[model samples]
Every structure is written in C-alpha cells, then in structure tokens.
Target chain A: MEFEYPIEGGDFTRAGMASSQVKKVLKQLNIAPAIIKRIAVAMYEAEVNVVAHAFKGTMLVNIMPDKVFIKFIDEGPGIHDIDLAMQEGFSTATESVRQMGFGAGMGLPNIKKNVDELQISSVVNKGTTVELTTYIS
Target chain B: MKLTEVVNKLELEVICGEDLLENTVTGGYCSDLLSDVMGNAQEGQVWLTIQVHNNIIAVASLKELSAILLVKGLKPGKETIETAIQQGIPILRTNETAFEIAGRLYNLIRQS
Candidate 1:
C-alpha cells in the first residue's frame, strides 16, 4: 500500500503526523513492534526536519509484504554539502527552531541510524529528497 | 509499578488521563530533546522533561510511553491536553526542576 502526506514548514504543531500515521499502519499490519518503533523514529525525525528547515515537503510511504519504503521531498534551502550535513553535529536550523529543543544537529544522523537504507540528495537552491527503506517480516 | 502509585508518590498533579493512570510503569527516561527520547526511550517508561507541546504527545505515544512528567510546572497548551486525553496517556506536572525531579525519580524506580 502507498500513502502521501504534506508537511508545512515552521508548523511545529502539525509535525510528526506522517510518522504517527505510518506507525499506525505498521501496527495494523502486525509488523514487529521493534521494527515499527524504528520506523517511527526515522520518519519522525524526517518529518520534523521538513518543519524545521524546508518551505514545505511531502512524505511518500510504500509498504510491501517484506519491506517498507519512505521518501521525504522538501522544497527549501537545499544542503550545500551532503557529507557535512550527514555529520551528527551539523545543522543549519534557525535559533527559534533550536530553542524548541530541536535542531540539535542529530536529525539526519538519527534517521540514518534507524533505517536499513538511507539516501539523501539535494540541490543548492531548490530542495532535498531523503529516501529510507527498512525490511520487516 | 502502577502509574497511579508513581503519581501519588511524586505528588504529580494529573493534567489529563486520570482514569488511565492504571498504566504499568516499567522504567523512566529523561530528555528535553525529542529525537533523543524517540531514539532511546523504551516502551512503558515514563518521560521526564521540561518541553511542552503537542509534539511531546506524539513522541510519548509513538514510544508507547507510560506517561509524561512535566517539570517546572510547565504546562502544554489546551490542544495538547485534549490529545493526551484522547490518547489515554496521562500528563502529570510538578513545580520542580528536571534535575531535582530526575534524582527523586531515579531513587523511586531503583527502590521499586
């Protein structure tokens, strides 16, 4: 099955909606609780990243019998250096975002730690795309 | 430990989910960072933090946390309370700082 969710930037209140929904779906599918938890963490960090940095974004989730694939596409100031951004302590989030206990420079790295596969692509002035895949049986 | 017993011992004011306080408490995790708790907190653990927002509810729920203990008497907005009520996750409050409360909670859990 497939699903898509729109994320609005600077809207902290509505963040995590996609992750929550995906978690619910995974639970209903009787996926292992541990796998569901990992997906929740990865998807939530990605969702919050969109709210913290992007102008707007979309989360696309495709769940198969043996695996789940998710993508986050955000339109905003893209990462100039994907390598640097992958570092645990690198973040360009604003002060306001930091004050809310977010933007601790752990978002991407945290997402990477949880997912079995992570691919990040970005253009300097346009946007970014994060692809995540995890297998569950 | 039943969540109700923790509330009584800690003198936590119930902000919501009063009827659901019978949740089992296995442990506790303290962090103000959302991702940290999301990455590390175990299910049935109570979360201790000063952050208050609707997203806190999301994190607590996603982690299958037992309850949220808001230190410094910091209260979430009305919508947050409503969501917690709906989710059956209790929101408890105290006027102590995180440092003060964590110590007490650690001792409580240890003794249990």
Candidate 2:
C-alpha cells in the first residue's frame, strides 16, 4: 500500500501527522513491533525536517510485506553540504524551530540510524529529496 | 504503578483515552526535546513534556510508551488529541511543571 501526505511549512503545529498515520497503519498490519518503532521514528524526523526547512512538501510512504519505503520531497532551500547536515550535531534551523524542541541536528542522523538504506539528494536552490527504506523482517 | 494514581497525584486532566487510566506504568522520562526523548525513552515509560504536537504522539508510539503527560497545563491542539485517540495512546494534562511531575513520578516509581 502507498500513502501520501502534503506537508505545510511553518506549520510546526501540524507536523508529524503523516508519520503518526503511517505508524497506526503499520501497527494494524501486525508488523513486527521493533520494525514499526524504527519506521515511526525515522518518518517522524523526516516529517519535522520538511516542516522546518522546506517551503512545502509531500511525504510518500510505500508499505510492502517485506519492507517500507519513505520519500520526503520538498520545494525549499536545499542543503549546501550533505555531509555536514548528516553529522550528528549540525543544523541550520532558526531559533524558533529550536524553541519547539526540534532542529537539534539529530533529525537526519536518527533517520539514517533507523532505516536500512537512506539516500539524500539536493540542489542548492532547487529542493531536496530523501529516500529511506526499512526492512520488515 | 497504575496510571490513575499518577493522574491523581499530579492533578492531571484526562484529555484523551480515559479508559486507559487502568494501564500500568513501569517508569517515566521527562524531556521537551524530541530527539532526546526518541533516543532515551523505553517501552512502557510515561513521557512528561511541555510539547503539544503530533510528533509527540509519534515518538510515544515509536517507543511503545504507556502514556504522555503534558505538563504546565499545556493542552495540545485538536489535531494532536485526535491523533492520540486514534493511536490508543492516553494523554494527561497537568498544571504541574515538568520538573515537579518528573520528581513525583520518579519517587513514586522508586517507592513501588
């Protein structure tokens, strides 16, 4: 099954709705508890990233019997250095984002840790696309 | 400890999942930072925070947390409540600050 969510930027209040929905579906599917937890965490972090940095975006989630694939595509300022962004303590979030208990630079790293495979691609001015896959077994 | 006891001791309001008050809580963790909570919280632990967002519920579900307590009387928005109800995660709202709640819960758990 595939699910899609349109994320609105600057709406910190509504962020993570998509990830919560996905987590619910996975639980009802009777997926392994551990895998479901990992997917939920990874997806939530990505959702927050979209809301914090992107102008707006869509989160695409594809669920299968063996694995789940998540894609976060945003039309926002792209990352200047993927390596730095991937570092555990690097972030460009404004003070406002930090005040809401996010933008700690652990977003990307947490997503990467939870997923079996992660691919991040960005153009400095165009946008960013993050693809993550987690195995179900 | 039973969730009801925690609610009564902390003087909390049941925002959602009242039926779940009978559920047992093994321990607790308090943090407003989502990243820190996501990294540290364990299963069946009660999460105490001032954050009122959908991601809070997501993190609780990820950790299989027993419940969430919103401190300082912070009420989550409608969407947050709805999502918590749908996820079967109980949320309690309290006028007590995070520090007080954490201290009380810690003592409670230690005593039990």
Put down candidate 1 lDDT per residue, A17-136, tens digits, no spaces. 778888999999999998988999999999999999899999999999889999999999999999998898788988878777788888888899999999999997799999999999
Every candidate's lDDT: 0.90, 0.87
Candidate 1 chain B TM? 0.96
Off by over 4 Å in 2: B53-55, B73-88
B9 Cα displacement, candidate 2 (Å): 3.8
lDDT of 1 by residue, B1-112 (tens): 8999899998999999889889999988999888788888999999999888888988898899999999998988998998788767899999998889888878888899
What TM-score should be assigned to candidate 2? 0.87
Candidate 2 - chain A - TM: 0.98
Model 2, range A1-137, lDDT digits (tens) per residue? 99999999888767777887888899899998888888877888888898999999999999988889999999999999999999998999999889888988899999888899999999987899999999887
lDDT score for candidate 1 against the true structure: 0.90
| Model 1 CA RMSD to the hidden true structure, in angstroms | 1.1
Q: How high is the lDDT of residue A15 in model 1?
A: 88
Weakest ten-residue segment in model 2 chain A by summed lDDT: A12-21
lDDT of 2 by residue, B1-112 (tens): 8889888876778999998898889899888889878766888899999889776887787677899999998989888899799878999987878888888889988887
lDDT at A89 for candidate 2?
A: 86
lDDT of 2: 0.87
